[model samples]
Target: MTLFKTVDATELQARKTAAEEQFRGRKSGIDHFAGNDPVTGRPVGGYVEGGIEAVLVKYAEDLIPVYVEYTTKGYTLTSVGVVSINSSTWEIYMNRPAEQVKPLLDAILQKVEDDYIAEIEVYNNAIVDKAVAEQLAMAERREAKELEEATKARRERIESEVRQGLKAPDLTKPKSGKK
Candidate 1:
């Protein structure tokens, strides 16, 4: 005897729609700027944005079936996924009863959530990298400016000494009479 229940197309579609809505609600609840550096505890700027392209439901009526399918540092990226019940069938089969449709949907949405989190990490890293690079470049520019100013000041001091009849002694020549 099979435990799997056969759902009609309309019922399956309704369930799929509800699942998609739930996914959207979850996605919307996520804080777009909630990323933080693990080491520093500072806010790393990145946005979490994506959409559900499509949600597919599989109706097993004594048959089988199957399926499947980033964000800003400076540039914005769009991501879309086609979430289907069959893709997570193995997980659902192993973890929950096949007749329980909600669990199956939840499993698929959980995968989607995991993917979203991964993308958020990627964007956070990118933002941090860009900020670090900018800081390094600023430091270099400041150092170069200081060096140039010091060189100019030294040159002015030397010129002033020469004007006041103080000449630097030449060490490359032999003494006048002790050659």
Candidate 2:
């Protein structure tokens, strides 16, 4: 007892045609940008910009997959993985439906920007802390100088008062036992 009935040849052909048409229609909605080789103007799939070719090559030393993957339920499409790369431009084949690819790319770009901002914030905090420490040290030095000047002035005032009350003690004179 089979669960499915076999269709006629004509009906099967019609079904195949309909499925292809639907796939083509979905593919048509995606935007394609021309990524040319910056040096030769030859059409290329990807490019690595910013003069850091060695570093990128090192990371991509292994195989880079360009195929697309479907979600577990087959309802969503993952990234249109790396298709090609040239000297400074890269292309992602991403044969994804329009709705899926655009938002995914947007989210990825936003994440990168956010991470960059976080790193900058950490660097900025370090600089700010150093400046604050220097300012505190300067303030302490000023306070110490002010205290030293005040103590010197007080000592001079006390000596002057003693001199005015009694004659200056002679350096050569010996002290008497009786008051």
Candidate 3:
């Protein structure tokens, strides 16, 4: 489940607050986040405190894309509701005009120009990890093979010297056929 998608009016405002100039190169946001992630040294995905999505884009301030979700019931609007917490922020306060929301959202296009879907995976897939581990294991096996080859060469040298002291081969033997 995702919120603040499509870069709608409210999301545009949140983008403005976060600033598009900052989100360059990196992923936009997570599906859900619950505070920071220790493994990645970033925030984890789930839901931020107070049911808001707060992310600190690269070199940008925190983007709190507060949102709502309405589940349409059969007919009588039984489950018309909202999600995300609309609350205070420490930075400058912002409130949009009801009529000019579109224009305001449009203005953000100048700063952002275009938006792409942000994809973030929580863990490295098993296949990816397996490939990496296999590569590492192959490297170790190669090293072991080289070490074994070196030991074999040394052993052959030592054995050859011992055999030479016991009985050396005749260097001058009769030629099979005279030229």
TM-score of each: 0.35, 0.39, 0.28
Off by over 4 Å in 3: 1-128, 175-179
* Clash pairs (backbone) in predicted model 1: none
Candidate 3 clashes: the total is: 6
- Winner on TM-score between 1 and 3 is 1
Candidate 1 at 156: error in angstroms? 1.3
lDDT of 3 by residue, 60-79 (tens): 12332322111121111112
Report how far residue 163 has shifted in candidate 1, in Å.
3.3
| Candidate 2 Cα errors over 4 Å, as ranges | 1-98, 172-179
List, residue by residue over 84-131, the lDDT tens digit for candidate 2. 466554433323444554554455455555655566667767777888
| Cα lDDT for residue 138, candidate 1 | 100
Q: What does the lDDT read for residue 73 in candidate 2? A: 19
